[model samples]
Target chain A: MSPRSDTPSSPSIDESRRGLDLGSDRRFLAALILLGGTYVSLLLAMVAADLFYTTPGHLWHALGSPEIRYAIRLSLLSCTLTTLLSLWVAVPIGYLMARFEFPGRAFLDALLDIPIVLPPLVIGLSLLILFQTAPLRALETVFPVTYAVPSVILAQFMVACAFAVRTLRTTFAQINPRQEQVAMTLGCNRAQAFWRVVLPAARPGILTAATLAWARALGEFGPILVFSGATRMKTEVLPTTVFLELSVGRLEAAVAVSLLMMGSAVVALLLVRTWSGTGLAGVSSLRNG
Target chain B: MISLRHITIQAGSFNLRDLSMEIPTGSHTALMGRTGSGKTTLLEGICGLRSIRSGSIWIGDREVTNLPPGQRGIGLVPQDGALFDHLTVRQHLEFALEVRGWALERRETRSQELAEWLGLTSLMDRLPAGMSGGERQRVALGRALAFHPPVLCLDEPLSALDDQTRGEIVAVLTEIRNRTGITILHITHNRSEAERLADRILHLRDGRLES
Candidate 1:
């Protein structure tokens, strides 16, 4: 065969092969992109449809109603209390699980997940049963927690604490234990090192845990409904408000409550993202040192 | 004086077996070892960060093998400084003094003294993230010296610095040794560094010390 003829055919063949490869790669990538985008669009469409279901005037009226107002106030106070309590429990438990070796560490770690994996209704029912026990019942005489304002906070904290613990555990695990070791060598006891060094360094994780716990508490309904009874203006939070409105055939009010919760969750998540993003850079750079 | 008597420590897969040595008070002793030779393990064992399988660590007149790291009174400058990310250099130096229950006025004076000695007076306001490697090491050194422990342990302190920075740190170490006359157990891989900073050299191979 002539060299020129062979060269021309080979170049054309290689070009065609390259085109085929690029075409197939583009098709595969496009299909995956479309599939992922469609899944996200499905969620967006559901939220958007629910948001616009009622007229703007109707939503405003529902939001301004006395019942909705009570729910909003109750939701904010209970969620904030729940977040604070969750962090109190999360920090110690997270540090214990991350830094110490104990006989029951794995068991305790797994037990922490029960709240996350269990049905919300079960958690509520469990709390209800727990208060009925002789000791808790005696303590209830002094501090009435069940079916009261305190019940709302307790229920939210039960689930929120689990999530917070998980977040903070991962945070502590990511930190170098050498920092604590060095601190100890520099004359700090274990508690001092944890407070001055580890806790401050884990600020991003703490913020993330608090945000997640707050969001979870804000949306918590099943536990509140079962344990706290969701009485009007008493134990009613935002999620329970939706249920209460739907029971009373107030469709617009229920949709408006759902929209309010969605808005709050979005805003809270955005704030957390901004805070953690800036805070993490400082932490990572310090860790690098 | 610092002494390890029949020290046997097991850390992960590495075991420091029956290793014993003594550094006289005010002597700078270098422990030279290759990577994975358990130099850090040995250092941490002496610092009480790692529990020994069987041994006793003595700092000055006290047997610190059973004591916690904080009560052992041995200061450690870990590899890469390991400075607190959230604390400024001044705070880093003041931490040990505060923990030791020094009065606020005394802590301030000691911090100022350490800053001047380490050439960190101007950088005291900056956090470790903004400092160069050499600066971080200097801060670590100052922090380790803040409590005035009779013995100090340095783990690969100069390994992360450039040649110029390393020289500066070695000079600082020499000055510190001269002024305070504190016992130093420095771990390094470089022979020249050991020779420069240490009055006595001990080689570690396969986790066993060979003087």
Candidate 2:
């Protein structure tokens, strides 16, 4: 007799085949998780080392130094102001881009990201040329100073607003306007539905936009240096302070400022990660669909 | 009562032409149509989400054809439930109540009552994302009925659920209708769903209401 073939439809065989396939793909998944974890660990290590090496006494002494204090105060004030102003403008622009179908929308959206890709020095130089000129200089003179504090704000504002608008627009785009329409059918007018339905939905995106804009404004240096000279106590923000100390061979001072900025950034990152429920909600909504 | 006459709307390539139907007061009416049979477009036209070229929509004693969606007291539960993903189930109910300017205590009580009625008491603290499809539909239904509009419209509410969940939701919806006596216009492609839930059935084909 010919050799008999025993081909049983065993469930165990099917499961083992699936198990092998899964085992084969596990390496790629492990590599991705490991890479991400390593990147985060490196960031944490850098931050901890900088902050720890600078003793409290050193930081306390630096805090008393009028130049450092001025830089800290100015950075905080300007970044806060820039974040508020950018949000006021970005929210509406972002909402319009997300909700409406209009001419040049794609081009408008692309234009918003230009600042992110464009060099900060170039942005600073462009503003310097634009506002430091005859007609624009005349406009600038209405304020006490142009090439110092205000210029820093203006440059920071320009870049921060660009990021804010782009991030918010993406967030709003993720939300469906159908929710608002449904709210309307349930006896809500436009304003009512917007506040009760749409705004709440878009809050996470708005918050993310705020955080990113604040971070960008805080780290701003090249633009501030080019447009607003790095005059200590006048236009010197944190990053510029770091650069000035480094150039003067005051490595300890530079490290201290770096640590401060790092702490601020870490706090911002934690806040974003912890309270980004809206972002999480939007992501889940997309996944559900 | 709500009535539509000769409603025509074109969105991109999809066209609904000469559609007409009537939803009587205090009756649950079902609109059965295949996908792209203009079921949603027709519903949107009535709610003013879509502008119609030629049509008359009357709600109660008023002609609301040209009124904005908010001005028409028509409650709509979309396929997605359209619940604000950021809001808690309780907040979703209160959002409508607050918009209608209901007193705070009343709004709170009403939300509580609705949460209990829909068996959503345990899930009241959760967002739409945390809920199952059936749970979300119940929440959306509760939100729509919170303020008690003159008429309610449900667009394929059960189409997204599994068979077991679909049966459970249909029973819940039926209970709601029986309790409130609110007129409902439910649009669905599933004939079995229509048979199980509707008091009357109207079919749509090529944008026209068929006998």
Looking at model 1, the pairs that clash are none
lDDT of 2 by residue, A146-210 (tens): 56687878889989999899888766666666787888876777778778777877788888889
Chain B TM-score of all predictions, in order?
0.97, 0.95
Superposed by TM-score, candidate 1 places the C-alpha of residue B7 at a distance from the truth, in angstroms, of: 2.4
Query: For all the predictions, what are the DockQ values?
Result: 0.54, 0.52
Per-prediction TM-score to the true structure, in the order listed: 0.88, 0.85
On TM-score, the leading prediction is: 1
Show where candidate 1 strays beyond 4 Å: A1-32, A132-134, A137-144, B12-14
Task: List the global CA lDDT of all models.
Answer: 0.86, 0.82
**What tens-digit string does per-residue lDDT give for candidate 1 at A1-289?**
0001000111222234433244648888788779999999998998989977978888889878998899899999999999999999999888777777767677998999999999999999999999999999999999999989999999999999999999898678667788888888877777888888889989888998999999999999888888899799889889988998899898988998888889899988997787666555654665556
Q: For model 1 chain A, give the 10-residue run with minimal summed lDDT.
A: A1-10
Q: Where does model 2 sit among the CAPRI classes? A: medium
